[model samples]
Target: MPSPAPSSPLLTAFHDSYHELVRFVARRTGPQSARDLVHDAWIRLAERQRSEGRRPEAPSDERSTPSPQNIAPRAYLYTVADHIAIDHLRRGQRTAQRFDSSGKEDGPAFAASPDVADTHTYRQALAEVENALQQLPARCRDIFLADRIDGASHAELALRHGVSVKTVEREVMRAMDGVEAALHRWRGETAAPRTGRRRALSSLLGLAGLGVSSSALWLGWRQWVPQYQLQLATAKRRLLRQPLPDGSTLTLDADSRAELRYYAARRQVQLLAGSAFFAVARDTERPFTVEASDVQVTVLGTRFEVALEGDAVLVAVDTGRVRVRDGSGGVQTLLAGQMLRLPAGQSAQPQAITAVAPWRDGWLDFQNTPLAEVVERLARYSPHPLRVEADAATLPVLGRVHTTAVSGWLQLLARTLPVSVQPEEAEGGISTLVIRRRS
Candidate 1:
């Protein structure tokens, strides 16, 4: 066989760890100086390789061996950043000493006078960058602090949290890009005008991009929102309201979890567990879709709700129209004030939407819904695992239960229905509820 082609190990290493390495540097230095530090690190690495005579002699016939693939690039990149940050701090200390000995204030060179206009501009730019980072998701923020501040490895985090390494990598990428974009916008907006005295102003603006415009900032926000997935999870008896990337909003019910994804051609959400109400924004060019248990709902713009109960999917439309498709390729169109239940291996059964997604108003309305469904819905908000006997599970139930009052609703079931509620305590102070028909 012919000799295998030589790959650029340096390029591969940079590609694998560029985002995370820059984040590591940014935590030590400010975001504004992170780009320069990373660039300097790369230059020094190349110089070291050249001095050591490790440079490849030819593209096809390499003389020097590349860095071993088994060694993670993150460690190597982090080492380079550590040296850069130390040098930066040392230079700053030395400059401070010079100012002290010369009887001069240690302030920015651009702000020579105390009342200079540039001072206010610089402060405002920095404040905006900080505020933007604060608005990022909590998980993203935590990952950045752990990786950059504590110097934790991605594999270490994965093992500690019982998640895959890819999860940590994604979170780091999201936060780094988000902070970088915010700083870029800040620099672009606060760039000074080029004049006789400020001829170097153009060089400052070039760090962000070529041009500075509101459209550019908006486009940056749109593009960055899709790089990493956004997750919304709620604990028992707790509900959450989240804003979507497409200017829409969603309300997740108790014990629910969902993931949002916005692509060029479509805006999609996966209802991983429980129920959620979607107030989708109008986008005819890109239809909004919800993927749930064995069913998918597609709409251009609408107010709708999807509930994943067991193996079935329940869809309700409050406003606009919804198109639901089952796993068997059966399609059903539902309009405002309409609802449907799609059971596993069964066709969609349409019903009149009597209350326009009562859950949106903090109520779970059931009209002749099975007792088993009532128990199942209440279980999401209940602190204990709920179990219903077969006879009681088959009985019909009709009531509007409060989302946050699951215990009260179950108690009412024992009073009105021919069933008894029994609470069992297990080890570790854990409790469970069992409902069965009265003997």
Candidate 2:
């Protein structure tokens, strides 16, 4: 029988950290190219060693090796692997810039060339993304990495975690938002390129003299129009204020998201999820409309808040009138100091309110609102989900609840209402507060 050839010292080092290196690269370049990058790393390591005149030192007896430390430092291997992965990315970017044999530039290429990739700005963005992932909660990080890096579907994650598909979706959304928020914070001072905006505006103005107005230009732009999405993650505990193209301001609550689209006929805002307060600009010619959950609210100019609560849409007007039309052909008008709740399969009914959109002022006023409903609202600002069980869920809650300290309010519920709050005992460290009736 012939004895198999022993692997080289470099190969041994790579084999030891193979899985870890693949995961690390996967986090950056995604899973599809992770293995290729890993192979590139090994080749780069050998080339680097050869250039430095530091060839792999082979031991006489491989079996006599003391430990992994004696073979090669894992840190050195990982460092070399990272450098190789980065260089691979840079090369890819450079390739993207050059025209192929067809004499056409790869217009869809977003990869940075070696020169651009070597810049500190490029490295900083990469670091920011990694740091953002690190900052996510354990469960959230697991779900995100599993779904993104491991290519697990939402159903798989839900089944693995024993939760619903909606929960998995929310976790993924949270992970993405966390990364975006971290990058935004790190690059807050960085100014956006004004050339594109200037060009867009110039194009619009150039057409205005041709009897076509800015709105008409926007209508045409809608064909290839770009849309911007804003996401507020759980890690971002502050409200986000965004200025729309038409000068309107949008204030989003924590853990909220929305998409903005501008056109000549209308300025549309889609509440993809979560709560938002819109201070719409007056444009009678192009009415502002907010579409959320099966309902659409239109207004020329108004200050109002729209919250997607379960299967219902809560529309509260602070200043101007809001016309809400449901999917079932039901329409109603809400004036200032009035609110309406349009539940699924129900018409919009106006209700009187002393103050509209109180949450904007850091106060949540609910007159005889169910404890379950209040808990649900508070869950948005809370880091964890809130669960009210037994009779406690039906208790009517009145007065105002402050948004700053939801924990204190929950304790108050225990004191005032016949309920007790406690953390649930679960296999995974799921952050959930359970409120049950006091025995």
Candidate 3:
């Protein structure tokens, strides 16, 4: 270098607390890579500031150099270092998993002799993805990678970054959108091939005019297209367990129906009718969403249930955080042991809950649930239709109803509530339980 750059106030503070920062990182990642993690953290901090169009101001004299506290918050530095350590450890684990006893690389790698044009395009796409990730805000990038690559939970990320779980979810979504946009740009550029000799020449030249083969274009498109599409439904009184392409599991309640569309960028389920519980696979790059009428529930990875009850949509989280947005653009976040109800023409309000989708465990738990709604749910398990009169439809019912014993539960319901059950035989000899207010 012509001359070493003068130390800025921030750099000076970093130097002053270098040992402490390394010690902090060591506790999380062990002493092996602690110093390197701290160094990387400083580089990340400096790069972030540069990207924001701010250069650190250097003190004129040694005496004027501000104290470490005045220059930069030590806590921020520690946070950056902690994130770096997490990434480093995660990468190390992956590396270990990739190599065999003979040290032969077993992870994904380029073919020993791949097609030149296709390889070039692939490398370009990879570079674009990396560039897009780098352009993201430091916190956003770290949070996304930690959740996706390191498998860190949103709550853990929030605690580490000193932010709410909602903030963490937003940052992850932002990062994913950024990376997806970059991939789309790369695909758009490479998907179209030039004509005839020009295309061949461009491939040979390996210049800015590079052209990919039609086969390569098809392969690229395949990566972006839907990987799996399925329509799942349960017969009356039957429960269905389905495994998704991405390793998630779906349990459909009796008479439930759902459509699953899995793409490279997203895993979506349209809850067309009844209720379904999703044990989502974690892929922060591809968020999982459940669309239920006017309400949409989104999560990076979690176990939750979505149900369509008449004009109302119900969402409950058994684990992880879930974000629910209504047709009116109102958003509510539900944590573990929390539930939300969105009625037609009304806003969603999240409430604390003791159980999430108790129906999954062979019982339907109702807390002051309407009689009509309860009857409709029970009808799914009953061989005969269950109906309630208008006067008793709005009556509030409480307690658990075992799915296997709907008849017994109905008997108890008729006993407790001011309602009588009348068994009506239809023209086809099909019996129906008709409940009416007691005379």
- Considering every candidate listed, which one attains the maximal lDDT? 3
lDDT of 2 at 51: 46
- lDDT per residue for candidate 3 within 1-439, as digits (tens), equals 0001134445445656776876888898766455545644554444444544454322222223333345455554555565566655555455455432455566542212246765666657656656787788889987876654444656678889999866876787577566556666765643233121112111222322222222232244335434467999999889999988788999999998999987657888999999999999899999999999988899999999999998999999999999999878888888999888888657866789998888878988888999999899898898788889998999899888888899878877767799998899887998989999997
Candidate 2 backbone collisions, by pair: none
Ten-residue segment with the worst summed lDDT in candidate 3?
A: 194-203
Descending-TM-score candidate ranking: 3, 1, 2
Candidate 1: the clashing residue pairs are none
Q: How well is each residue in 265-351 modelled by candidate 2, as lDDT tens digits? A: 677888976689999989989888899988999999999999887778889899989899986878888899898888876786688
Candidate 1 lDDT, 1-439, residue by residue in tens: 0011124365346546666767887898666556545645554454344445553211112233234343445554565567667666555455445444445676442211224443354445445544655788876665654664444656677676677766766676566555555555766654333221111122332312222222222233343333335889998888888887678999998889999877546788999999999999999988888999779999999899998877788898999999999878899999998888888767867888777657667788877877888899888778789988898888888888887788878877877789998898877978888899997
For all candidates in order, the CA lDDT equals: 0.66, 0.65, 0.70
Best by TM-score: 3
Candidate 2: stretches off by over 4 Å: 1-236, 428-431
TM-score of 3: 0.52
> Which whole-number lDDT from 0 to 100 does residue 10 have in model 1?
55
Candidates 2 and 3, the one with greater lDDT = 3
Note the clash tally of each candidate.
0, 0, 0
The CA-based lDDT of model 1 is what?
0.66
